[model samples]
Target: MKSLTSIIPAPPGWYARWRFGTHRTVTYPITTWALARDTGSEHTIVVGVDTNGMWPGGDDERPGGEFLRYIYEPIEAGTPDDVFNPVKSPADLASVG
Candidate 1:
């Protein structure tokens, strides 16, 4: 088992990975909205096991089993705001043209 703790918050688009004994590893990336909400806070983190290039061992090596230990920290409670505006429809574009 492994544990990670951080006092500084991760920034949007930031990513990190951990490798265990050159065989397994995990990675995480920060969310965009969290960065916007708290420029100084590090809230989001993820943990996963890396099975890259490993051969499947039939029933013992199911896809679900590969990522069973992966964990992603959730964002704080809040209504998620849309980050992008709605695009114009084909009709709207034709009218503009």
Candidate 2:
């Protein structure tokens, strides 16, 4: 079985996409539990997750068990760019509109 660290890859283009989407700049918390704080730039937003070891399954078994909490965060637009950077600036919005 793959370790959680090995299974979860670092987010690709997270900084650039997040910066562009929210229009400001954003920073991730040093630890995973902290709520992401928005930098309040024109179009920036912060995103985060909690790693509280809430998974189910016995200590001797793999994590894929009945009691596991399957938390699914929806990525809208069904595309990586759309899901990551769904919004553009006001000027760009005008053109798209």
Candidate 3:
């Protein structure tokens, strides 16, 4: 897997994407998750995981498993939570979309 914005390498059963946001005149693409919102984090961290249908580990609109996104640091991601926590500013949310 790879980060959506930075194309950084990710481990198997793991993936990374950015929150729908904006900063300093740059706008980040909108997504569905409670990932990092800062510009630096938006570019590097913000990750999640997934698996085949039988293992129950996917999170897109797809059926079976769910790939849970996160609100964690780039260096640490030992826990897993799937609560959709909104972290972007109202303006950022409105503007990015």
Candidate 4:
């Protein structure tokens, strides 16, 4: 049997997708989890996958087409409480379309 992590690297949760033009689409499990800090700001790291689903030839032929995508968004600055708290589980992640 395959490990759960291998099947679903992230816990099931509300996800978000960002599209860049007609060629790229990025989808990730959304959360308020912060991974680092920069001076007065708390930065949240989110890992996602990019897919060129509409590409005529498909993504397999594109160089490093299946590469992982990492994003960092600033959550807050200066105050500890202002920093967004981590979403502990998929159930806790906010619902979205």
- What is the C-alpha lDDT profile of model 1 across 10-68, one tens digit per residue? 44433333333334443434232121112345543433212231111222333332322
Candidate with top lDDT is: 4
lDDT of 4 by residue, 1-97 (tens): 1111111233334333444344544444443322322334454333332222222122332443343333444434222221223544545432221
Compute each candidate's TM-score over C-alphas.
Answer: 0.21, 0.18, 0.19, 0.21
Report the C-alpha displacement of residue 75, candidate 2, in angstroms: 6.2
Clashes of 2: 7
* CA shift of 17, model 2, Å: 28
When summed lDDT is taken over every stretch of 10 residues in candidate 2, the lowest stretch is 25-34
Top model number, TM-score: 4
Give the TM-score (vs. native) of candidate 1: 0.21
Ordered list by TM-score, greatest first: 4, 1, 3, 2
lDDT (10s digit) by residue, model 2, range 1-97: 1112212332422221122232432222112222222344333223223222322221433232223122232344233322323345757543431
Q: How much is 38 displaced in model 2, in angstroms?
A: 41
Which residue ranges in model 2 land beyond 4 Å of their true spot? 1-6, 10-50, 58-68, 75-97
Better of 2 and 3 by TM-score: 3
Writing each residue's lDDT as its tens digit, candidate 3 over 1-97 gives 2223422333322333333323211211223322323344534444333221111122343332232232333336432332222575767534543
- lDDT of every model, 2 decimals: 0.31, 0.27, 0.31, 0.32
